[model samples]
Target: MRLATFVAFLAISTTASPVEKRADAFGIDISSHQGSNIKWSTLKSHGISFAYVKATEGRNYVNPYFKNHYDGAKKAGLLHGPFHFARPSASSGSAQASYFISHGGSWSADGHTLPGALDLEGGCAGLTKSAMVSWIKSFSSQYHSSEKRYPVLYITTNWWKSCTGNSAAFGSSHPLWLASWASSMGPLPAGWRSAAIWQYSKETGSTPGDQDRVSGGSAALKKLALGH
Candidate 1:
């Protein structure tokens, strides 16, 4: 992630401060470090209707705040989704996805929780670009087999180009949460015509983490939240 790109991300996003007004259904994502005192009501009062909390990383690492954040977000009346950071080299995607599910990514028919997500950023866990694509496929396959719904894929252009060769295999089936700070989504990896959620900001003191916008507004957001 280039500094310039990250800066643009902060600018494009409306920011997490409740003072900023946004018409779309924008949300925030956080990990254990956000602390347990996050005022979820304050976010909801500001128009944040949903959130994605980090659950697990690789396979063994679990977010210390996942349970709290998840339950707290729900208590605040905000839709919640749990995300897992992918570490293809640490373990097979199948194993990692299963582990994530076992920990906190489990899907339910409840409309408040979205399907699990795979955050496939950062350096490839030591695999070739082609091998990285294979890793995602394996992970997605395992996740879908168990949940009956495709877990959302969150990624950036540089990582995708360098790791997966920008494979289009999962585009049509999996909804994408594209990470780009540019004014445009730029060129999406092959297959995906558009992104479902655009992570427009990475620097925002108001939210304590990254913030994003759901492409289809609140209605579409409801569908994703319901895992439809």
Candidate 2:
């Protein structure tokens, strides 16, 4: 009974409350690990406004369910896009960016399609801090050359500091999709003043995957999708 009550509370808290409904957007980031049976329409009804689907990693290894998640999110009326897992030690950033774009990371002007995101976390993959920063710049530049917009950068404060030696090169250009996972967003990486998206919890409630909070409401969400 306590577990059930706790679940009820979590559902109420994670799904947009009245105040959040008026001011912010809630979303999820998912991959094949979440399985292919997601009920996206139900999540939208529960106030999910967007979704990020894992698309590719390295120069290969596309997520098998990328299309399903992208199509399902679109059908459910959620702004949706793909994210690429960074592998700086395995391949050139430009090559990996090409692989990601050719596979499913391409962006369009469609209102519901969001620009691709770069999921850069974990260890530095043995690259020097300068190399890591250069790798990221190469990836961002390549993605922009192809898609006409820089990919959103998904990172955590500690990882950013440790891996890239707290590089601020991309902060001015790339959107920060910060993974803080706390009651509130803590200190950001150097250079960024705020995050465009915050992955607040790895847990899901009335949603299929990790929970996220958008900084601005629907207008900002639309602007992000529009690449403004």
Per-model TM values vs. the true structure = 0.87, 0.92
Please write out the lDDT profile of model 2 over residues 141-182, one tens digit for every residue. 899999999999999999999989999888888899999877
C-alpha lDDT of all candidate models, in order:
0.81, 0.86
Cα lDDT tens digits, model 1, 139-224, are: 98999999888999999978887887778788889989999876678888888888888887675444336778886567878888
Where is model 1 more than 4 Å wrong at Cα? 1-23, 204-208
In candidate 1, which residue pairs clash?
none
Candidate 2: Cα lDDT at 152: 97
Compared with the true structure, model 2 gives a TM-score of 0.92
Count clashing pairs, candidate 2.
0
